[model samples]
Target: MRVDLHPFAGIGWPGRERCGPMRRCLPQLRDSRVGIFGVGSALAPHVSRQLDLLPALVPALEHGSPRERLARRIFDNACIDERRFCIPDFRHGTRKVLYDTLHPGLGRRMAVYRREAPRLAASACEPALKSARVAADEITHLVVVTCTGIFTPGPDVELAERLSLQSDVERTIVGFMGCSGAFHGMRVARRAALERNARVLLVCVELCSLHQRDEAGAGALVAQSIFADGATAVVLGAIRDHDRTLALLGEDRTCLEPGTRAALTWEMRDDGFAVRLSPELPSLVEGRVARFVTPLLDGIDPQVRPAWIVHPGGAAILRAVQRGLGLERDDLASAWSVLRRLGNTSSSAVLYVLEEALARLAVGAEGVMLGFGPGLTFEALRFQRGPGV
Candidate 1:
């Protein structure tokens, strides 16, 4: 279904007439009062223009080889216009010529991540806090999620300092969960928002560029073609008076397509992490997503057909999910927009899609946010647009 990103976009349900009657009639919407007040996302300054990627990949490909042709074809067909990067050289520089000589070890990559990830996280979070009218000191818990980079005094610790959050604020960092990692963080914030006097801040940041490798294999080429750096922040709390936000409804998490574990995997190597994406992943998802997502929506009220906010892991994944769910292309417009504009920002991607979806949502509108990661895992959360400011 097509979703419009505007204040007066969807069918309106005035005042308590929105959730009050629906909650009683449909138990699924009964207790969903927690809301997301604001969402902010930021891309790094270094951008790879639309035509820059193919030329950059050309030098990496082996001359006069079939594999090289395949690599070029993959990059050409990735459906990405441009992508921002945390590493300057990955953008418009001579890095292509020096790529073979540059072997950034794990230590070097970690150094860059430790120095930059928090800055990007804070940049995204500050505006969210301001937009929500939430003071840094007022936030009781902080949740940071990432799988791209790891270093102590992690982004969580540094963000608390950078954002000037309270000294005793509770903090949690979710690591190595790949793209769906932010869903785990959102789940944490969802629980925190349920507590009295608690305001939650969730930050998702990924410096996928720092993990770039010189390998020209299919997996590496796929990783290089799609991954980019980005950060997003979300403010969540129990619904308050006059709050214009999206309600935090129930969530469902599951591991699907067993024995397909080798289809997608991410592991740490000496020179950054490695990604192995089997060619079968897209078709596997296409075949299984319907069964996987159907149960998540089964118990919800049939009248509240939630809009879909899917993680655009790649163009293929988006197409796979759309067919699996019997949805039209417009249903995934936000996802496609984010992927074309920013590529896959790993864990921060779903948050970007959510931000866009919420922007277009009208009061009492419902939506579903889905993300996939390692373990062939799927994280799905149901949300409803609540009252306006």
Candidate 2:
């Protein structure tokens, strides 16, 4: 199912009347009312390692082996210089090796997640609340997004306790959506803020490092070379007078490209969650992104050139989107910066780019964020800087 939400203009759902011209929609809010008030991010505590050390760090890529050679090539071309991990063994030698046999049981991995995810998530959320100038008791809703790990009495419950949020704060979790998960969480947060006039706290945290496997195959190698661990949080609410927030301008209909379900897949296995990335995925994005983005662009004023916040799934995916949309390299600088420094943090990756873009966006500037996930699904959120800074 696809959803096109432009609250200030009007919403477009299947079987509903399509949104009219901007002139007809402009008076609904006088100006955008709902928006992102603040953003904060945190990385796993372990120090990062350069790409060159990965073979030595991961046992699956033993020196002088075929996998090691393949990994080196992929890492060199990945455009990533360093990546962090929650597991200290990735950067420092430890007798208790996590991926000793390339097959750590799912139970073992999840145990690590249950212990660490909440701490990292809380670290991110605290600063987000501080930056938004909203106290813990003021949050009316909580939304958490993740694809890396799961447990009952999950991170959502722990986050509230760690942050001292009220016991009655509404909570929701968006899981297993892969890289596009943040957009899905934002969609939910937008609804809560608009429908209930709520102050929503959205947290996206991924422990991708825990899923690294020593399995053989180009797909596994590529995934290993580019995935990392990180968390990001954003506070959403009604834009106040003279606020310098990123207003929710609109959201385009989400599209699932046909016949591409296998292009990207994240599955849970006896060992742990595994990611399979088809080499053809980049080309698929290049072929479809323009058509996917056209309708959303048509809804906006033609004179405005919106900034592009495409997810940096990898260098290839970023280039594909840039080529498809006729965008310049500078258009995606924020994405590339994140990819180079942190690798792909899966669900939290796009928000890192959004945090960077927030610092550079001029008052009244507009931008679009795009994310892709397991279903070969593409999601888009349109936003603009509110009037006063």
Candidate 3:
């Protein structure tokens, strides 16, 4: 709350003499991998009505067999039907039926980076970096995170070299952490800072839509429609004084419905990626969310501010989040804006929500960044603003 809560917390810090408290907090943050921002990419097959999922889910529908009956039952009662998703189909003809969406080849990946990385760097990370920039030879550690491709030479190395980061600067790559990977990366960065007193840079890039599947059933379509791609890069540094606009606030997390793993699944295949989404998902969230999340929000004030920065999995998913969290329509405006502008960007979506929350919501207010994936589980982090957080 000192970093986030106390600001609007109705409890102001008593003095500029924060040395004792900051010392206690600084060491804890040293290697905590505790915080960050989000980046995202667009969905592949580009979410069009021209493509169809009804045919894919009920392949033998035209044959009129018992399988069709089973398919009907599955579709009628499943999340797909209830969610009103049109399988968010694709437009590729050659790639259609062969796979969901095209995985980026090296050339294609470079093409995306060409247009995206520069603009993103200029717009997001660069501003933060510029805010925190210092004389040369100061930055000591860098952490790059992503989960959407294959490459031995990897984007991290390419990014560092391109940016002219110090040649000997310590660099690390975090891969395959999934939607919650950035948090996982923060864990790693926190450790690095704690051990070496290293200044760290966390970069997130996920072209989520690149992993979309084409001829899959409703599950794949739904997941792909809601998941887009983008990148986020931020610098977390240590400062003796509180003059810096940004500061780390306390953070807490939890998992839910551990047994519900079958609710959502993501796996790679020769045809791209296959996902199985169950209709029981929203209900799972509705039932368990309050129990799981409320505890996480236990000490926070809900009356003055109960804002939420939920990863917008999709339009329906947002609806589920609102109902589950017991929030009114206006509580998650930032989340909706990101979802409307950029689909779910996996791990980065939460970061995008955080960015939105920081920019749009009142400072020092409490908010939750929540997401759910294959675990059929929920992951949430409670946060208040950092200094200028």
Candidate 4:
């Protein structure tokens, strides 16, 4: 019954200059006890390509030209040992390459997404429901998050069918928010739980590999080097007696860095979605993240150091956050570990980090989750380990 309410208690949305638009304050839900009860994740199983195989899989990286050499260096230092892909052609010796002189078009890529995303979602959701000790029929709400694909009768519908969720389950899709998509989904889940004591199932699935381009530009190189495929699911509801969970503390309004609308973007192109990440992104995040994040910690006891579950955008971004917050590498170990193990699975990445953090946190431990995406937007969630954890 000990609820920590300092972070978001009675905080209104910031002005347009600060947060992009006028908006109502997030509901404080002081009387409700929403919390994440279970976490599960699954990776695409078709191809597990190592960093060294990149030059072979993508001929553009094999050339010894200056741009290609630099791309190779980026690949080498990506902090990723291997990345899973739903596309089998991403492997080194595929008989038919998906990305030849002409890369796969958007339609083809989305076809793969439609086929694979639901299966991956179910793979993650099954374990999530099992761990939450909730049955499929008990779920009253479903929140699906993704940025890699889109089509009519999307993964949301397919996932419900695959999982045998109730036909009446209210569904919401948090799409195209990029890496922070899961945070939005979590927000929806929390709101539903608070409003109706709803049992909410949240799923994030990204097939970043489906959007790969053969271009040799810095942005393309970086995106290809770090992006991968995975899905993660979480079950949330009113905190139950004797339940071990990460109690939802509060969430900050989306902070859009001024004049950074173009710093990072995922845009649709004929050949799948094209990602453009400016080299200045790391420094931009480092310079502004502290200012944006400090308010959430305003009334927190200065002596208490909370765990950080950061989206692993890349090595540079992780190091920047560490330096900005003056945190030790150990503080962001889960982020780094996920990056090394799964590359950047976009929306699912932060939840993967959260899963890792959950295993290590002790009872009553508090943690902050940070995710950055398009709009150069920043999403922050504050949570604590509930009693009986």
- Write down the TM-score of every candidate: 0.87, 0.89, 0.69, 0.90
For candidate 2, write residues 1-389 as lDDT tens digits: 45453322122333222222222232222365678887899988775656655654456556788778877787789899888777776765564457665567989999999998999999999888887878999999999999999998988999999998999999999999999999899888888887565899999999998886667577777787788899999999876566666555564457777789999999998878878999999998887776565555544555566877878899999998877777778889999999999999999999999888888888767778888998899887777765422
Q: List per-candidate RMSD values in Å.
A: 7.1, 5.2, 9.0, 4.7
Candidate 3 at 274: error in angstroms? Answer: 2.3
lDDT of each: 0.77, 0.80, 0.54, 0.80
Clashes of each: 2, 0, 21, 0
Better of 3 and 4 by TM-score: 4
Instruction: State the TM-score for model 3.
Output: 0.69
| Model 1 agreement with the true structure over 1-389: per-residue lDDT tens digits | 22222221122223222112122233365466777887788879778864576555345666658977777678778888899977667555455322444676888788888888998999999988987888999999999999988877778889998999999899999888888898888878888888898999999999887776768777777877888899999888887666666555654545544667888899999977888888888887776665455544545556555688899899889988877676778889999999999999999998889888777888777777888888787667766776643
Q: Give one digit per residue, the lDDT tens place, for model 3 in 48-77.
A: 321233453324344456654444544433
Candidate achieving higher lDDT, 3 or 4: 4
- Count backbone overlaps in model 1: 2
lDDT of 4: 0.80
RMSD of 3: 9.0
- Greater-TM-score candidate between 1 and 4: 4
By TM-score, who's the top model here?
4
